[model samples]
Target: MAVVLAEILAGLGLLFFGLKTMSSHLQSATGRRVRALLRSATRSPFVGLVSGIAAGAATQSSNAVALICGNLVRGGVFTTRDAIPVVAGGNVGTAALVFVAAFDFRLVVFYLLALVGFGFHFKLDRRPAWKEWLWVALGLTLALLGLDFIKQGPRDLDVALISQALDAGLSPGMGFAIGMAAAALCQSSSTPTILVLALMQARLLGLEDAFFIVLGANLGSGLATLVSSGELEGTGRQLCYVHILVKAIGCAVLLAAWIAVALAGGDPEAALAAAGGSGGAQAAISMLFLALQLAGAVTVALARGLTERIAVRFSPPSMEDDASRPRYIHRRAAEEPATALDLSERESMRLIKLLPNLLPDLDRGGADFSTQERNAFWKGSTAIVQAVDHFLVDVIRAGATRESLDIALRQQARLETVRALVDTLHDFSGVVGEFETVPPLAFNLSESLRVIVLSLAEATDGGTGDDFDLLIGLTADRSEMLDRIRRALAASEAGGEADSRRLMHATSLFERAVWLVRRVAVALRPPPIEDRAQDGDPARQEAPEGVA
Candidate 1:
């Protein structure tokens, strides 16, 4: 009994670790691609199911696939109807584990262990060639090890004692209820079903009795998924709902078939074994069941597509108009550096207006965010920086007349400086935990950044125009303000309290912001192009900024 118990624990441990490792690896690899696929595939219910199955198969985790689908739905990538099919497909894909484990694969465990150990120990090396393949091998081995333990371990259980207990405790309804609870507890229908099968193989439970339990197991798995999936909304929640409906319907059909067979005076165990014998054919039967599950999923996906089309026909209008959409520098738009510069200016101006409120919004404890919301904010920020950098790269690459090159170089340098500033701001936002530092420093520093950025916008549009004098004035004013902030920060530091470290950090960040603003002013200040041209001096034209 102790040995059997030990095998069970070891098997469970291996199973959990294998699934976790496999899920993490697959998620990291395919997560973004799957997200992209769902955006378009969610058009029809069938497409959703196929995408769900494909992604779930790739990642080996239905929950991850479902959660991602849900976030996409909330992000407006797909409608709830579109998500349903994919989610249903995910349910079918999740059962692929049963197919894999059904095979005899005990020998792979040695390779698996070595690979995992090597990968863990050598992770810091930049050139770990084919490390991923090793991880995959290790995961598959762990899965096989667990399956082998399950198949071989149960024969030694005290069957007669367990049978007596079950006979006293289990009605058809009770068996079904227990099976559902077990599946829910396990969180993987594959595990629960295997456990139930193990129980039967040990002769502790009859086959006929196990049939209702399997029915309960499917329902329980659906319910468990639904309950967990509820934490998400839109496509994710819908996917779980569709999965539940399909399983509930499938179970009803199987349950009725079981009852009919019993009424025909057949033993359920004898019947099941005869239908699919105890040999490799049993494996075939499991595979067939999996295929049927996939077929059901495909059908569900088709239904969801139709449902989505109908919903779209009656969709409501959004509150925000197209004109209200904020424009930012786009990678495609960067081909035209002048256009990119224009977009960047607009983006800078938008950020300036947002500065006062950004900290407050981020700081608000009650600000509710969907996963999509946070992802959009982060992705948008990344995209903005990337687009701007692309523009700068293009400008640098295009070698021009010496005079033109000097202007371009200065502009490029200015952009690089501002990019550094924005990156620092982004870092600060992350450290301060999304707008938690809503104080005067954040406010004033943001305002100063806006002023410099606006000055750049003017400079980019044929050299600061009327704001050239304004830029100079603002630069002098900001210099004075920074000096005051620095003195205040130093005084705060002199107090030498325990919180001085944090305050000093804040001061450092503020100083960085000030420096970025000053750089922006310097970059935007027009060189004496008119004077150099009038003097007909090419040397003066080629001078870098600040040359005597």
Candidate 2:
């Protein structure tokens, strides 16, 4: 009994390891391409469904498709409405795996494929590009091999004893519970479903028992997704909720139908015999699972509006889910410093992007900066800066490589610069808010300041050194104009000494704001390669004559 248990445990471990390895590598290799495809293909629901089917089949995991869709929605590439059909089609694509599993394809074929994959990986010049696919092939081979081992494990034991242990005291509810537990433990419905089919083939479990187990496995797959999506919020959370809800509803509907059939005196065993015994039973089970999934897909697609309403109601946004918080600096991504850095960079860029919106424009004179807008902007910008800082600290603690650390440091520098820019912009907005009371002479200064701000904003928007020299020239021209304004205010007596001082103070604030904006643009600009080799002296590489 102990030996049989050991063999079973080993087989399950291999299966799980293979699945994890395969899914991770597959995601790494194809995630960007899949995202791009989804973005381009999701012009309509039907196209999204086809894209999802292709992506899910290629990756061999519906969860991967869900996650990819979730990311697309989170990134604003797709709406929650668009993602629904893709997720549904992912279910259909996942069913393809079960369908393929029903065949008796020799394990040797997988092994040969893995070998060929490895050979290609080593022989190819693009090893980095092809290595993930090889790992995926190897993982599939190991998973198939693990299934074979699991099937052979109980052969040497007392088949009657094993069968009795599984079925003698097991009610349908108990079978469902067992299957759910197994799938959750494995974090995979396919593994447990295939195992149940193997048990059916060994004559240790009947088709009726397998039916409940398969239902439970489907529910368990959703549970796994729910657990994984715990950290996601807003649209990402909605995607996960949709996945779980659809799966649960489909499984429940099937379970109810099965109960109704049984109550109507339907013989499940007779049905299995007619389907062609054990092999037919496995295929039938796969078909039933596929049908339930397709039914869920059709139901959701037909009522997309209602489905979306339910999803929104269930996964409504929280205060933290608002734009004020760091949207892309996902804590879950901290384990991968490169990903964390990328997310942090995006969040920082978001904060910087808000600068133009937050800046008060006198040219649009009647536009009022409402209290609500100001408060929200202030709160959101503050929260994002703090969140990004905390996230960066976490990334550092996660022990990044030297290259990753350098990237993180650069991101941190950019974050600090953005913070500075925001602070300066806030002060400048306050100055502009008092523009109504300013003397007429300050209008020319105001116009000059506006041009400077616009120019800086454009430079920041470009986000490249390609225009740094141009910005530097503009800044120099503005600085000279700002000096003239200050000298005129100092020399004037028409507005009285107090008005002159106020005008000068406002002008000073604008000058400082322009300088900070220019600094941000310069900081964001990548240094030339020639200067990069200076080893920490890149700052010493001077801009053109106009730039300080």
Give per-model TM-scores.
Answer: 0.64, 0.62
Sequence-dependent TM-score of model 2 = 0.62
For model 2, the stretches where C-alpha displacement exceeds 4 angstroms are: 110-114, 117-122, 125-129, 272-278, 324-350, 353-518, 521-548
Question: At residue 360, what lDDT does model 1 achieve?
Answer: 19
Candidate 1 residues lying further than 4 Å off, grouped into runs, are 26-51, 71-85, 107-129, 215-292, 306-357, 361-506, 514-548
lDDT of 2 at 394: 72
Taking the tens digit of each residue's C-alpha lDDT, what string does model 1 give over 217-291? 777877787667654533335555556665666676666666788899976556556665555334533543464
Residues 1-548 of candidate 2: C-alpha lDDT, one tens digit per residue? 68867777787787667767777888788865654577656677788777767766665566667776775565445578988888877776777767766777665756666685667766752588777887787677766666666766666777788788876787889988988898777666777787776677677887888888888888888778877665566666787777777678789788777777778899765564455446577778777778667777667766778888888998886443465646676656888998888888878877776655555455665264553465457656866787788688778879999999988887788778778767766665665556546455555555555666566656666445556656665655367777887897778786667667777877887777667766766666666744434445655455554555
Per-candidate RMSD, Å: 7.9, 14.9
Which structure among the candidates has the greatest lDDT? 2
The CA lDDT of each predicted structure is 0.59, 0.71
